[model samples]
Target: MGYDVDCDKMKDECGVFGIWALGQSEEAANFTYLGLHALQHRGQESAGIVSTDGETLYVHRAMGLVADIFDAGVLAKLKGGAAVGHVRYSTTGGSHVKNAQPLAVQYAGGPIAVAHNGNLVNAEALRSELEAAGSIFTASTDTEVVVHLLARAHPAAAPGTVEHLVGSVRQALGRVSGAYSMLFLTPKAIVGARDPMGFRPLVLGRLKGNWVLASETTALDLIEAEYVREVEPGELVVLDASGLRSERLFPDRPPAPRLGRCVFEHIYFARPDSVLFGRSVYEVRQAFGTQLAKEHPVEADVVIPVPDSGVPAAIGFAETAGIPFAMGLVRSHYIGRTFIEPQQSIRHFGVKLKLNAVRGLLKGKRVVVVDDSVVRGTTSRKIVKMIRAAGATEVHLRISSPPTAWPCYYGIDTPTRQELIASTHSTAEIATYVTADSLGYLSLDGLYAAIGAERTGFCDACFSGQYLLEFPRRQNHAPLRLVGG
Candidate 1:
């Protein structure tokens, strides 16, 4: 009966935001709300923020969008000069209020909170160790493991200080393994750190003397913050009333992993306006379209995108390949990712609910439909069929990214290899399944060329099946690796 956020596309796990000011008069709670609103595209299942005004901590977390979870009165009650916030799209745990973050826990260091934007490859191993050591967990999230680890790592008798708090969590992080861009919120300071491999994006910014940290620069732009720099790979950033300082979390670290950044961020996860991994998301997507045109050229009357996400790439493809672009497929903007079918009599049901073919334009035209990526082939198949039913003479499907053949372990939530159409079927077989006259996916080399980066310098695990973390290769299990080893 109510609205729920359920995206059919491959979704990133979450986004994080934090703000801290010393003598400045910024309302952290209000600004954080705006930052999260800008990042609402990153996650929509749950939202939360924890605030601290030097002594006490206030937290509010619930299931739904940022606006649905907070109000003027709620933020006013969160009266603090510093805060940490998160919008979640569960990767490690189920969707529930208990699994929502900035997971606040009371330890020897008073009350500390953590907001994370990644998955832990060794979370199961760490949880087992903690449970064996008699630790109790209230949530089914990998983040809870950090809470217990910090408690055990800290000196039980010492009162928690900013330095001690960061140092303790740094040691704990050293022992765990996986991709994480995290913020540790304590009464004294907010400490931000990234994994040694830099698998996710996190940025630093300053707004009217207030220091800020976020998963994307777009968040900073929404609040009029001056863009700082990225939280460097393996770096620890500490922000407080005095200002911001830095430390390295992986000085004596794992074999200098050549490069392990996530490429999917550019392909689909990040907002088009966001600058990530040293390039504009919009530009990279356009490149994907250009490359797709080069790799697979088809004579067609018009080039049409599969609605919103594919628009940029489709435009590039049309321009490069010398084809006219048209809005052959119209998307219902009001349809919020998920909706109840108004009636069962509607044809092509679910897909039609979100997208409808423009019969007037598509009729009698040989059209090329471009999309960002093909995960299961279900949506692509539906779109192809719908176009044909709309009277298109021929339907050709073009994917900007490579075939998603492997599962992602770092931060992305992907289907198993058995479920990924590419992993189980050949290119020809996939085209037949989708009922397209022709099909083409950008090559892995073509993707790197699009991004202007060396193939070895990024994480294309979902496409290439070359994962970074060394874990036990088992069904649905990439056995966890120790971070401190």
Candidate 2:
């Protein structure tokens, strides 16, 4: 029902965080801003910051990008030895300033601000229960559920106690289900926690004596912070007077089942320059294209990528296929905001303003078009039609990753079952629907090899329809496949 013009329909969410100790003299907000800018590709909706001077907690949050929301004056206002910041993309919240992150709540102890990076599967039911119990909600965001739970878990009388805060968070997390990587800001410390599955990323780093936790290591690199290590799945870290301390929150759950790092992190979600799970995102994506070519061979005069996200994989595909590659389509950097435009009519029209076919490159070319993944056929179909209109002799679509058949309950914004193009149709049907001359998708094995991660270790739930974490039962819209993208 939302803007359905784009053929491939996955919109990724990004979470970024930065923090400084009470004694540190550095401007924590500015460093956080730079880190968020580096991670901007993950989310573009809202930004917030909470800083503490050891005695008082200061906060500023709004619905806009980091660049648009925070300036020198705003950063100066958030004066503190320590701070936590968030850049958000709403997978389950309304796109308004009220729903913006660093959701803060005051108690007798002090103020606690939270920034969350993933979605909670049980949010709807939880919100209903809280609302019925007299919880007045300010924002219709799942994140506020945490605050409600925390308030109930920790009594107001408990003051200046990290143990009580941790206990409250643990109790709150015990009742919720699904992926989350969150940063908690108290006047005394900044804390980080990851869900048991580690469905989203949270990494730890250090700059001088200051500590930082972010959704990706790339953020640390941007601010010249030294990468300490990834905050382990189910691990809770507190940066306080005693420096960094970690505790196991969900000890009963066994170690990650092959460490289900989200495969899409490299395919489409993460920045190309970012490193994840000790591997280069750029290198992995290129490998994905190379593996895809080996698995799905096709004859073509030239190979072309779908631009931006698909460029790395497309290059790999071209090299592996021994075909020449060209920048066949150029993206318009001046495209208007898709979420802010008054209606879908404007957003759909905005797509054209963002992308244009290169007639000179497409003319008479037998092009093998490479893309990261296909969601709904809308965007892919439009792109194929555009290439044909641009005079390409034939357009063969090759996807580096496998088709997305299931909705992601973690963080990525994938449509429901009925809206997925691949869920209801076979590859051939999808090809015809998208108007591509021929179509090929990377096999699950090929995709595995592309990223070079252990097959037993990564989470391909979106592609395979298999879930590692226990989730609330939903109707099985499609049958599970042994092989996935």
Candidate 3:
């Protein structure tokens, strides 16, 4: 069962999946269930699935993990030919069951189920316009904005029935702005689309005769699906019994289309086992560590990681620096990695339950402790203090990415700018606050080098102040209502 846990860290927003096939509605729901299970790591707060057998749509959603939401009894009830699933960590709307997605709606065109992976930048503007037009909203999610837009749209051209419906959706899609990797499921077909800047990851795959779409390739791997290719930026694909069809949403292709792919996907969000932006997340993380080691070589007797999240970079750092790598800090895998300690007195209690320093390994040693990123610095401080208590003669902290100095507005749940340690403090100050003898972070250029991709085509908003899209001049700094925080 999915349980709620609080910790000082970046939270992933959501995972989306949709499957459609010829004569496979009975099995489509099962495939989607497994796919959501594979992507459970992305979001653990709530999960839901919507399936359709061409004439009717079946929906089941709840505030819990996918494993807890469904079973043989539930799956048997969801007999359908096409299915779409979502696992969510609230970003825009609060963690209410009403906000849970594969958000099904009935309109003039009939049943539509939508699943989304990224936030909308201009959701407030769009929501206001919809409300003025007499639209009644049930949830305060940016996704429902699209539904309202669909209400006002007319089929631009209708040579066929399915094409007419797709045209109507295309018309509504043209009116929006911001990062979105969306799945639109109808009785007749399943559709997937990515934003023009492509700020989130979405991939296409196939299982037997079934066509599958998901936020990460790992979802496909779980069901033994063969990966097709990434859904390109500004591209919308429609899958039905006739098969897959695609159209570019923003067809004004530039000489070199710049896809503002989220760099954080490689830095932390994506599963190491998944391939994103055409690179293995594991390999990229290792590269980030290798690059960090190049930038910050330390004289230490041993190298250790902060635990599970820090292990990959730690491995890379150890290999690159030729330092001995050991589990100096061990994580309690049995404990919910997401443990909660709401009381101020128990703040340290939560981190302790998750990780503990190994006194035997750290005794009399100069340690190089590598971690992925330091967000609030509170947890990192507690960790460093624990390592000191474990008898480490010295602890030099190393990070695999540039310090996050800004907040992310796309699908990632992060502390506000004021809460970000790096946003208001210098590296020296951060080191002092964390109580580390010394500290080092990978350079921005080094991070780009690790990805082996040109930096110009990526979103580094959280690291650099430059935003890929234009922000409103009068910023409220309020959390987006359409997309989860």
Candidate 4:
């Protein structure tokens, strides 16, 4: 069989990169590529890079993974001192080549390449306003809206002035609302900013005398960069020859939200190796498993994880329950996220094509399978069926997260309420629906212990229906209130 992009689609968040050459143009692309690789978990739809020398800007964007999109030949063609890159998964816009990012725009002044990590709740409204004023769009992504806003926001100044560039970002921020951790690259320097709420992550690092900015600390770790610190919420930071400068964009925008951080960053989105908001992602997931063990103890001969995403939690479950942990399902690592089948109707059939049950390990065993979370129920049901077909005596399902009942508006590609399986089914109902012997989910409180209380905070609207921000009243659905589990 030929290679097919794995179509087992999950909620994907985009990754962003920023680089200040510090007179070293040769290594910027390599550093950004390694950084993006560490952040590959953040997105898989496409990868793009934009770089600027003191004189000119270079851009290269294509659909696929970072390795697929740029090689030495491609990177050589992109020459610049300052650079910014993006790996994108379009949650708000239709996925297309035009939607691939580090979107470069040519304004009346010099060009600016922009890469963004979060969602804008007011995108549609903002797009409408721009369209009303005759702004033409090349991509459907909300990121393009920022460029349009910047085109208007750009102050009239003499060419090559930093004032004009910084002013544009400040102006765009005034007009847009919602979550964002963005990087802007001009010909001379790289600028990074986070929304006042800091719903997404962005960090500053230094390596070989150059400064770097990325969506996750793991990215810095991969490139052997020394992490300086997280870019403070509502702070705008500029990196250039003079060095790093910071300013608060929203000094009066209320007290720092106690719960403004993105919750899914801990759950299914981030790489387990990542350290988010002070807690290790793997440690937090293991806590989820331990919590699951305490809340819903189960009887089984072996505790097996679905692999990769489920390993940490399964390890926690096995340790807590004093059961042997085995590898139950093994995944083929060759496939890309865009793995397509012949048609949409049979698209999900690709999951089986990517993963297989180890009969020798699972045969005749009462197996407890742990996974991160179940979105639509299709994958879980199929996995259970596979275990049964492999001669498993009983399949007990353990989920490391509470039921996901709401669609994520900040960035994750969760489905609407009608399409979410847990939103429509109870825990017992889900167990029956997936054909598992029994099932249990970790509680919200359990997550705190898993990730630790002092290190993490989340916006768990999907589990408990409490949006950290006021719910916007939609014309299609009534205004939502904070609902408890």
Write the residue-wise lDDT of candidate 3 on 1-485 in tens digits: 22223355788879999999747647888989999999988888789999988888899999888988999999988878799999998788887899998799888777788898898878888888788878899998888898888767788554335775677677777787778899988888888889888898899998887799999999999999999999998888999989888888656544224668899888888899999999999999989889999999999999998877788899999999999999998887677645545665665577777788999999899999999998989888988999999999899999999998778877888888888899789999999999999999999999999999998778888888677776454454633222111
Tens digits of per-residue lDDT for model 1, 1-485: 33232334797679999999744653888999999998888888899999888887899999999998999989998877899999998899998999998999888778998999999989999899899989999999999998888888754336668877876877789878878999989888999999888889999999988899999999999999999899888889999867989878866756445668889998888899999988998999999999999999999999999878898899999999999999999988766656665665653476776789999999999999999998888888889998999999999999999999888878788887788889879999999999999999999999999999997667888887777777546666443333322
Cα lDDT over the full model 4: 0.82
Candidate 2 — worst ten consecutive residues by lDDT sum? 476-485
- Badly placed stretches (over 4 Å) of model 2 are 1-7, 154-158, 252-258, 339-349, 473-485
Q: Write the per-residue lDDT of candidate 2 for residues 307-375, one digit (tens) a residue.
A: 898999999999999999999989976553442556655555545656788999889989999998888
Better of 2 and 4 by TM-score: 4
Rank by TM-score (best first):
1, 3, 4, 2
Best-matching candidate per TM-score: 1
lDDT of 2: 0.81
lDDT of 4 by residue, 305-338 (tens): 9878899999999999999999889888875544
List TM-scores for all candidates, in order: 0.95, 0.92, 0.94, 0.93
**How do all the candidates rank in terms of lDDT, highest first?**
1, 3, 4, 2
By lDDT, the best candidate is 1
Q: Evaluate model 3: give its lDDT.
A: 0.85
